[model samples]
Target chain A: MSVTSASPSHDRPHWLALDRLGVLITLILLSSFLLPFALFRANRILLGDGLPLLASMQPVAASVLLLALAFGVGAALLRLPALIKLAAGFGVLTILFIAMGLSAETLMPADNNYARVSPAAGFWVLVFGLALLVTDALTRLRLGPWTRIGILLGVCGAFWALLWSGLWNELSILKEYANRAPAFWNEARTHLLLAFGSVAIAAIVGIPLGILCYRVRPVRAALLNILNIVQTIPSIALFGLLIAPLAWVAANVPGAKASGISGIGVAPAVVALFAYSLLPIVSNTVVGLLGVSAPAVDAARGMGMTWLQRLVQVELPLAFPVILTGIRIVLVQNIGLTTIAALIGGGGFGVFVFQGIGQTAMDLVLLGAVPTVVLAFAAAVVLDAFVELTSRGGRRA
Target chain B: MKPGLLLRVFALALLIVLLVAPQAFRDFFALFVRPTQPPIYTQGNLLDITLSHLMIVAIAIGLSTMVAVSLAILVTRPFGAEFLPLSRAIANVGQTFPPVAVLALAVPMLGFGTAPTLVALFLYGLLPIFENTLTGLTTLPEDVMEASRGVGMTGWQRLTQVELPLALPIILAGIRLSTVIALATATIGSTVAARTLGEVIIAGLTTGNTAFVLQGGLIVGVLAVLIYDSLSALEKWLARRTGRLTRADA
Candidate 1:
């Protein structure tokens, strides 16, 4: 829009450049001692030591080569193409991953299985900094949501494929994954079960409660207040609170154990998750129902439609889109929250997280954290697409 | 008279009751737990822990609001419009990156203390405030903005006076959401050795002490309710003052 205002060269902003001196400086400074480029350990005792990128010749070469290209492009006094920037970012990421993998391969003793070779906080900082630069360039291109999602999936798929092909087998995180390969699928299954079960329960309970809250006058405050109160209780605290009562039920109630309702497992995890999921679903449902136009309801009523028929035929369809959006939020939120389920001995991906914490192993933590992030991201995207499709249909109607 | 005042009075009474519950019901909770241990959270002083929790939340939310609001303002400007997607992506990263993961990542760099927790909380609180501020500023009436500009008000003056003031209610709603989230999420800070209410729950989890867990949950839940109510009241007041509320009463 402001492109037409270019009377003087000074008034016009410069276009993109490859090195972007600022980005180059940032990358170098970030990869240097300002952040630990790599972590080292002798045996299982993780030493609080990090080596700069130049600590190893191969990595240093990689860094130098990358920086040289960046500097050459930047110093050429020519604006870089958007496509080139994207490709360069992709290349740099591949190089960074390979550099880390190569360093790990060389650093760890081949004979010793217990020795750990991991990237420290600095490595992560550099990765993030580079990622920010790449995303900035990508955003400047103004890609659509589907295109962005495709880029994400493509990058992730390639990385996973490389990992599966044994390219990153020597990396400490993959090693952690290697050890838990059998259990990983099971934990993933449990994680999904925890997420989906709670979402299902929340929807079943919340939709009706939402309708009731919308219809009733006095019930709204009391019901919403309770749900809000429940929501505000921290996830860990909520899980802790459920332990006693569920324990009591398991001990005293006949057939409770038979039904798999217990104090410290999926039962309490799902229950706490269900509680957490309710506020969004219920509030969204009420909001959606209330959002229906008055004239539509009036017309239905004038047509001699019963109250139930009016609700079933008119209100639900109008409200379905908003309700789906709420469910999307709940699903994504629950996916992340379910990681806490492992803290209570409820089987899920959080098992790796807590175990990693216990062992003070960052790699093990990634073993859990990465999958959870992916699951949550995927659920949010899929549900969002669903919401868009339905809402568009609603708008058309 | 006013319903807002009535709600505040009710909330205040409820708050007082909740704060006193642990001390008042120590003996009652002892029935649920074994007779050997104390029934209530007596490890770290409950009041002190609560104060620390509040302080941590306050500082984190304060920092996040400043950054988020500034970014929101920047993105809405003509110069920074290309950055709207960039800012949104950054905020999404903050939201979608699990706070626990952030804490775990932060721990190695900042070590085990409040610093890591603060980092995690700051990131977690960014999105809601940013989104709300953007929504508020961008949705201001074109006529109002034009009038301000026609009056020769500078960019800064228009922002500080016309834009922000009118957008206060919506911005406050966002801040309210952020604050509530920060309050609840702050409990996880204790896992990293931050002195928050989560310490009570974590201790209970470790030792199978249900009474300790209950005390922690009760205090946090009550605190959340009181803060939420007060913020909602503040938002309503802002809305009313700005003439945003057409319906007189609920």
Candidate 2:
């Protein structure tokens, strides 16, 4: 690699120039050495004793982990290429995950049904630090968008492969998942339905309302103000607020109860999600349409295109990326808010979360939380890619 | 009267009525209650619960603002610029992780009660403040920055007198958003045994008492809106003072 003469490192030694990757690697080493790597619990809900790295795992695994750490330090201290640093980071991370699983297996007594082994603070710190290193290397490499997405998929596939190999089966979280495999899938479905269903509905209604708002100033002001007020209400309070009104409707409205329009279940939950979703959708739509180039619209008009034709053929196409951004925001927000819906009997992954909270079973809580986070993160990355692609395409067109 | 003043007065009046004599709404609440169920939350003093809830939110927001602002400031500095991408990635990813899940996860480490709730709120509230502050700090006009340097001002002086004053409006806006989110999220802290308004709603849910649910929901909802409005007003005033009102509105 060619070094720029203006860089401070030319005047000083490379080490003195402040290596950020080295700082992260040092942090990872410190955390791995200083903190407990695993928790050994006699039973699921009880407090566990902290276990240090070597004590928590088999000797072979511990040695491998140590070797990986050594390699990371070497990569950090040396002025290695970004590509090598990235490979080292990924290798260290994979070893960390495998070692974590091995640690759990080593800690648990095979015949003891109640024994639980969970990752501790050190493990998490190492994972976070290593992930940062990998991200830093990736940023330095400056991969294209498609390459980044490919890497994302590859990382996800690695996690799937690891799990499929039963490496983490001994871990408490996986154990908890095994116990409620069916319920986990059930809740996963419910979570998706609640989050996606509401966003879909919001788009259908919000897009038209947004167009109307763009057409009429007064309605725009009044409607946006109302939605702002709605948005200000917390998810829990809004869900609770909907209960009384919907319960009344279910009691009095002829077909409401039979149609599942009750206060305490899916109906109110979906309604609340839908309400929370409208502001983002409608506002983004308006903003997007407003952002369409005036020249483009004028050209369409000059071509004798009707208003609808101009809107459909020109404006909406230009605005789709921004509107999709709004939908992405809504989808992620709804996924999170859906967890709270479990409070009112709207079943989702939150069922596991709340159930775990009630039972003081943190593994169960992780079972719910981990998946929700993964789902939301996946949605964000995929949507971000789509937004980037469409925006690029729009500029080209 | 101006709509702003009218809203303030209405909010003040409602808060006073709710605290001074909640019984004023008892009859109305009773409409939703069964004969046997209580018409209002009787398990805890509503004012005390509300105050404790506000206190929790205040502490969490205060802590988050300090840390987030400092982190943002650090990352924007020349020496710390290397960390900017990492910090940005963290703030963005953290927001996607739900507040409720964060709250639940904290329980394992800190155990139940206000401590875990505070930790969760602090973490969840960090992103908005950090992101906004970073934007404010990084987006200052290049000419203005040059002007400050041309005056022979020290780094500290430039930050304090020039950068901070110009960025205050955006920072305040971030605080407003964070506080509003904290207020809402704090309600869920009750699930982990923190003393918040959610206790009332949870009680209501368990007993099928619509009145109790409505009482808690109304108070929390109204409180959030009022705080949100006041903070927004403050932000607007700051923006106008800094001659950035139009941009702030945008």
Candidate 3:
């Protein structure tokens, strides 16, 4: 599936235009804060005073121009591969500012004031629109990495801007994302801290647990069955189960909250994410350990090594990669599932999503989703790198 | 081999205690609380959650298999390869957009019920189905088709009789994956105003009642794993029946 494998070099020669994508990303990022200013002024100029500015705020002309610019950017990103991505990015961001300028002037009165034209909101809507369209065209056109990066950044920037400003604060829709924001970080801190702690705990618990399962048949069967059962429960339920007992301890025990026995906020989220992590780590570790050849383990014993010594020296080293692979899957899945904690008052990006739904603001929803997606993907990529490193070490061993 | 039996038994005991403990909290609620007519716990409603999940899984798998097989067959012809990358990219984009987002985006277009649920389920199920179909079909022995043609079978006949039969085991694996994913994904249906197991869990979150959520979540999770395991066993059985067990070593 490698693109450069079969196609003629000349056909994909335009893949070189990717450098401009960086410029596009930078401009879009910088302009997100500036664009709102443009809208504020446009309304002031069109409705308040200034005939000259009102002419500039003309919506019909701007609408036509924005549509033309979007198509032009689409074509540039699609056709040129790397060539016009940066240029197109700037144009797209500029078109967004101009479009907003026209819309605000045409739609709103002069009294409303907000600072800096939001380049970021444009990133989500028009920017992602172009990116999604281009994602299809990129393959047909055989564009390479650079051009795609521009589109990614532009989309990300927009989502970030809207989210930061709480743009989707509307009550009727996208409300789910907004309601949870006040406790958002406390929820994030609870879960994020738990995720950090749980992964560490999982490696401790899951690896040894996996080894136990590998060494003992009945034990492995029992644990695997339990882990499998736990894994199947949707993440929401997992957090719910973890929360009840912890809440009991908080209320009943006289000084439990002060002593940190309260179950509600972060603890349950951690436990849920942790339980979710257990199956993969344990199963993988067990598989990896059992996968070590019997002859090799016997050979280590034959060299006058005791059981523990053999495990430390030969078996464990050989089993590390498979175990690591399990950990990788567990961590990645955990991050993705953790987003739902917002529902449980455990809060992460789920707040924004739920808030957006309640508030009816699509932009705020994207703010949560974009980061969660990036977080999940980043976790996956980082895990892959670790797996690659450990796997390489495993190979050498 | 059974070293952890006692530990596991103890752990299960703890799980039972933890799972059932919320009832004690409910009893406490009755002791010192204002009288509200809403029941704190109900067993029959949990059963309803299970039935709804079954329906979602059934519809999702049925529709997805049809679409996936059709797309898979379409891609086999010479012209299909040109669209293979495109199809896969579409599947990727579809998956990359969270199921929750799919639920959100689909609601306006499809209205607020089972229709949106099915769309989300179908789109969510597509990647696994398509990938498996592609893998199964492409991996078939090239000579199988030649021999069918050598015997003068038409292209359609070759596909249905020879190619598909040969590809059944791998294709079934994809079906298995789709089923598990669909089963779990049905939980999201609750948020979209569709009645499913997720309603139980979401209600638990909103009302701070862990028992209701646990009831639904536990059942849904167990069902998915069991179905996956059952299909896995069936896949192996099919492989043996088809002489793949013996042929694999060779």
Top DockQ prediction, candidate number: 2
DockQ of each: 0.50, 0.70, 0.30
Mark the 10 consecutive residues where model 2 chain A has the least summed lDDT.
A1-10
Ranking of all predicted structures according to TM-score, beginning with the best and ending with the worst: 2, 1, 3
- Per-candidate fnat, comma-separated: 0.53, 0.59, 0.40
Candidate 2: residue pairs that collide? none
**Can you tell me which runs of candidate 2 are displaced by over 4 Å?**
A1-18, A77-79, B246-248
Q: Which ten contiguous residues of candidate 3 chain A have the minimum total lDDT?
A: A43-52
**Candidate 1 segments whose C-alpha is farther than 4 A from its true place:** A1-34, A57-87, A133-152, A293-314, B1-23, B245-250
In model 3, state the lDDT of residue B100. 63
Q: Write the per-residue lDDT of candidate 2 for residues A273-368, one digit (tens) a residue.
A: 999999999999999999999999999999999999998999999999999999999999899899999998998989989999999999999898
Give one digit per residue, the lDDT tens place, for model 2 in B55-169: 9999999999999999998998898897898788778788888888899889888988999999999999899999999988988988999999999999999988998898888
Ranking by lDDT: 2, 1, 3
Backbone clash count for every predicted candidate, in the order shown: 1, 0, 41
Choose the strongest candidate by lDDT: 2
Off by over 4 Å in 3: A1-110, A113-191, A249-259, A290-321, A359-364, A385-397, B1-50, B85-98, B104-111, B141-154, B204-211, B245-250
**Best TM-score goes to which candidate?**
2
- Between 2 and 3, whose lDDT is larger? 2
